[model samples]
Target: MLSALLVTGLAACATQATAPAVPGDTALGPVLVDAKRMTLYTFDRDNAMPGKSVCNGPCATNWPPLVANAGDMAKGDWTIITRDDGSKQWAYKGKPLYGWVKDTKPGETTGDGFLNGAWHVAKP
Candidate 1:
């Protein structure tokens, strides 16, 4: 368990490189986008637990988290957060990032203002 704790500590503090994702043009302006240019989003509920993602299970199914690869690290305004499942997800300025399944095309902000305005496009 000590090693696990150490790894967790490191993951929380270590930061490196540009994020795996990039900014893409959306009607919402420049929002964080995946390689496919699918618009990313942030959930207000996630604000409850700073740096943690609350959208899991079915919630995650609808809003897929912007998952970080094994070697991924936090950098600049981008920070790597540990999800409940122990998986790494990317967060910008402390808010977790996600993709909307409802968005079938790139630059789509259909997920914005979703869920009673709880969701909004992840901005740069």
Candidate 2:
């Protein structure tokens, strides 16, 4: 009986030890962070250049690309990119946009400067 109680207590402690959910930022809407999955997203597509994006495919699976809803009204510098698949993705310029897999919080910018000359933080 005592062993069972100890095990239950340990399980409860482990559950309570999990990291808290990342909060939303004023500039960014809702940022999702999955450390195990390694992904990050911004409220807007700020990292995109006039016509380029650094993410795609398998990279996209780790850092899922931010997609735009049809009829989704434009806000700020956000624009749309019609992919070959005919799906609309969000863009800053002509460049497509994406998130990173290492960022684990809304305010956390871990993905910033990743891959040396590749990944960059989405600017607002």
Candidate 3:
């Protein structure tokens, strides 16, 4: 009986561990963060109509998009977007999400309102 209970507890813990982190709001406002709590951003140059990402090549190298895995799901305002390279990325409210390379710490908003207002933090 104890062994069975231990197995059950381990299964539960494993399930929770594999669950993807969801976008949440912080003191800066509603923003998407990774498991490490790093802030996510969006680019204004990217179009919202076709549900595609325009930040590629060098742009993508500087501002990495929040990649989505095969197991990730779309819920509420969160959705997945397929980049031109055919990789899945996370998007919020139809905008492709990204992580600025300049942001070194959690809750850092240095990328917010960047590039003459072309970039802004992803808000819920």
Cα lDDT tens digits for candidate 2, 41-86: 4322334434444455576666556666655544445566665456
Q: After superposition, which runs of candidate 3 have C-alpha atoms over 4 Å from their true positions?
A: 1-27
Q: Residue-wise lDDT of candidate 1 within 1-124, one digit each (tens)?
A: 9999999877655533556678899877898898788999999999988989999999999999999988776778888899889989988899999999999999789999998999999888
List, in order, the clash count of every candidate structure: 0, 6, 0
Q: Best-fitting candidate, measured by lDDT?
A: 1
Question: What TM-score would each prediction reach against the true structure?
Answer: 0.84, 0.51, 0.76
Worst 10 contiguous positions by lDDT, candidate 2: 19-28
Q: Residue 34 in model 2: shift from native, Å? A: 14
Q: List pairs with backbone clashes in candidate 3.
A: none
lDDT tens per residue, model 3, 5-70: 999988866644442345666678767787778888889888645588999999999899888877
Pairs that clash in candidate 1: none
CA RMSD of each candidate after superposition: 7.8, 11.8, 4.1
Residue 22 CA error for candidate 2 (Å)? 16
Best-first order by TM-score:
1, 3, 2
